[model samples]
Target: MEVEITTEEKILIAARKVFIEKGWDGARMQEIADNAGINKALLHYYFRNKEQLFKRVFAGIVGKLIPNLNTIIQSEQPIFEKIQAFIDAYLDFLLANQELPLFVANELSRNANLIVGAFEENGLKPMVGQMVMEIFQAIENKQIRPINPAHLLMNIVSMCVFPFMGRSIFQKVLMQVPEEMYQELLKQRKKEIYEMVYHSIVL
Candidate 1:
């Protein structure tokens, strides 16, 4: 048996669905109200306006971003292991919420400042931009080879995130491995991918 949720919770759930489907531009307060089985006035009584409601939903999505990645980004772990862990964690985050990346990208495109503010709020600070510089310095200090760390990071993320992010495109135009099969593939990828990354970075 399932207990019913409060109207506020219902509104938030409806907003999430609308935002994911229509993005920030296309989402409408009336649509959200309709989705929640409430009138627009009731939705307004709860959320004030569409923008406020949108923020609530967007904030929840932003919070899904794992903060621990910052520690891993600056870690002394062998760069390859760090890369593998990063891919696994990041991809796992997306797997848990398939619409998140697209939602962020879409909303950011709508308001770059909002995206920046969200990052700041999330304590990501400026770590991503400097992540490569720190890695390069490690290489210069003989901790690793002179390979480009930013390129490595991007490649690993692309391999992990893109396959699923572009799942429809891949299944339609290229491969059509079932979802479970893809999950199995991802499960087996960490080791091989790390070895490949290790080979590139190790002296």
Candidate 2:
């Protein structure tokens, strides 16, 4: 049985594709309405304007990606174990949403406040504080080397996110690997990233 997609769902589906492809500045209401098989008037009826539509789409993406970090960071797992789990989950999400990094980069370049607002609204600051405290505890117990927690966190995020953001140059130009092979490389990165991060901080 084919499930019926609601009017709002259809609008969101079309809006996500349009916004991701064009960013906030380039996306058009007519294009979104056409993609959704609706009229522009109806689109405006659902969302007041393009900014509102873009915010809705951006919020949904950030909501999915950020809440998981909060959950994992708050868990009682050891620091290294948390690191491994975070890499696994983060890579899995990026694999599914390969276009996300580029889209986010483009949008952020246009308006930094969008991403910052999303993070603030999601309680990411407290999560970061918790993770830093965990790193401090690990260092105190001699579980890891003495490293700045902020730097370690930045390194971990860069390693996980940069490949996706630079996929075209890294996969096509530099590596010159085919799509299937490139996918395999990303899968391998989960373990590879965990090991690299583990060794970097471990004594």
The candidate that achieves the highest lDDT relative to the unseen native structure: 2
Task: Report the lDDT tens digits of candidate 2 across residue range 22-61.
Answer: 7888889999999999999999999998877777777777
lDDT of 2 at 24: 80
Off by over 4 Å in 1: 1-6, 74-78, 103-126
lDDT of 1: 0.74
| Shift of residue 138 alpha carbon in model 2, Å | 0.8
lDDT of model 1 at position 155 = 76
Judged by lDDT against the true structure, how good is candidate 2?
Answer: 0.86
Q: Which 10-residue span in candidate 2 carries the lowest summed lDDT? A: 117-126
lDDT of 1 by residue, 1-203 (tens): 99989999999999999988998789999999999999999999999977678777766765555465666777787655666767667766777786676667667778888667645554545257557876787788887788767687787776666655666776556777777776776566666666777777778
Count the clashes in each prediction: 0, 0
Which candidate leads in TM-score? 2
Report every candidate's CA lDDT: 0.74, 0.86
